[model samples]
Target: MAVSFLSTVPNLLPIVPVNASITSAPRYPTLGATVRCSKIEADADNEERFKRRSILTCFGATVGLELVRSSGTFVEMAEAADLIQRRQRSEFQSSIKDTLYKAIKENPDVIPSLLTLALNDIMTYDKASKTGGPNGSIRLSSEISRPENKGLVGALNLVEEAKKEIDSNSKGGPISYSDLIQYAAQSAIKQTFLASAIRKCGGNVEKGNLLYTAYGSNGQWGLFERNFGRADTQEPDPEGRVPQWDKASVQEMKDKFSAVGFGPRQLAVMSAFLGPDQTATETLLATDPEVLPWVQKYQRSRETVSETDYEVDLITTLTKLSGLGQQINYEAYTYPVKKVDFSKLKL
Candidate 1:
């Protein structure tokens, strides 16, 4: 979206009354003129300061993007993105509660697969180096939850779950971390599209499109596809590409994205597309309180949470927030079925 400014007056002084006889005329400033001048000065200062703030915010967004790309945190981004999708879909499906819970329980593996796909896409094409080489090892779990790693924990949770499932099903076979990473990466990219749609409908910023794109791209997972035949460079690039959240501006956001080959219109469109699902839980919570507590407890146990947790927590938090349906009715919303236009997407 285009950044808007409050109205301001011109700073140039008004032309003096022209008189051939008098070289100088009595200069009298009108009351409106003085007020306008003051307003103009204040507006100028505010715009300047806001510009700086925008740069800082953009920087913060960029850093989030880098963390996901470099740290193999695609799974976390997917989780966050899925939460948004679930919330959106819940708005249309009548059996959303059961569906969400069952899906959460059944496909713990989905997130990891998605995460891996996203990571592979980014690292494969971008100039940045892959973090964990065959010899260079790092703990994916710990890195996924770092403060600098905002917007990625959700998908990572899926990866953790996938590992557990693999261990359980293998009957003692070694689980493949590499495979999980590839899957999670893929899921993250799909989630970006889903999250963008929710945000367009006015969902919360915490689960918004901007964060999804920021985290996904900053980490280099959401980059454009290039010729696959290019040779792989073993060396890693410098780290300045990632933008910081608190110190970024709109211009900075535009600049950084442009540097990666995205334009202002594309950035704006993406920003308007995704967001978190805020009301999904509230509806569930309002419907059933007796079963809500257990759900909330289960959700809190994980370092990273998901829509399933939110669904469970909704029931739990609702019970705690308000009494059972004696006076309130908490029915889950239906899920949406309309597909978004993918052809219009820039990223």
Candidate 2:
């Protein structure tokens, strides 16, 4: 029998709340001391460990920072950071960078491609959740604006603003807000993915050229697609649509996506596929030793731990327990799927 794509797993994974209340908190300086060593040995073994730890911290901080900064906004600093990191890591050939730059500059639609990807993923997830369907009178803007959304909200806002500009410039031509928001959201996703990739490669957001193609560059990821001409609606969706980050269970997450018309397969794929990015704060604290203590304290106050530390610790623990990187490998895999063409569908 073919695999059922819509069926939920019997034993769902528990949602570990990052921001739960803690009974006792460690002092900031003490927490910082836990991760920091006083002296650096120039020995081979120590050097190797130092390099690994540095790389891990860099990646973790970048992801955490991007998450915090981008939460609920569209202006993408993460994209800029991704490009810089990519360039530093030499992930793309110099020739490829040159080409991408040319394409972005010549084609205004290039940025929109990234936006579309981000939007579609969220929309797809939303659609998959039985509890968060489009027909339930939920507001798109409100849902996008939730605090849990973090960096995504800003990206959505950018989409809304861009749609207005397009409509106004069109001199009464049809442009939908939905289409624009979708595009922006997808772009944010692309940015996040690229940023995440950079962190994985031991780079940070300071580098700009690696994050985005310089305007008018060629050889980008794909061809530019035209907008479907959707307009924005000012109305915010009623409450109870977006899932609380702290309260979300695997089942609840699935239900939220189902409500938005997405399926179990898509949800599973997304869970595995989406690359993580850091918040701005995470990046700053990780790279600078002076700020590490403060960051730890702040996180503790919020009943959260450093996201970067968590990612590394979780991966390390799982690898040790399993004696294989299977869990890590699975989490790293993403679905190579194309964006949904809303223009072709009768919405």
Estimated TM-score for each candidate: 0.26, 0.31
Name model 2 segments beyond 4 Å from true.
1-153, 164-168, 171-174, 193-227, 231-238, 259-264, 272-347
How does candidate 2 score on lDDT?
Answer: 0.35
Q: What does the lDDT read for residue 189 in candidate 2?
A: 34
lDDT of each: 0.34, 0.35
What is the model-wide C-alpha lDDT for candidate 1?
0.34
**Which window of ten consecutive residues has the lowest lDDT sum in model 2?**
324-333
User: Residue-wise lDDT of candidate 2 within 1-347, one digit each (tens)?
Assistant: 11111111121111112222212222232311222211223344334344544434534554454455446254465555545544432321222233333433444333533332242323322322322111211126555555545444434444444545544444224334443333333333344344444564357554432533332122222212122222233555445545543344556655654665454433332331222322432443334344355445434432321233332332332112111111111111112235698989986
Candidate 2: clashing residue pairs, number: 86
CA-only RMSD, every prediction: 25.4, 29.1
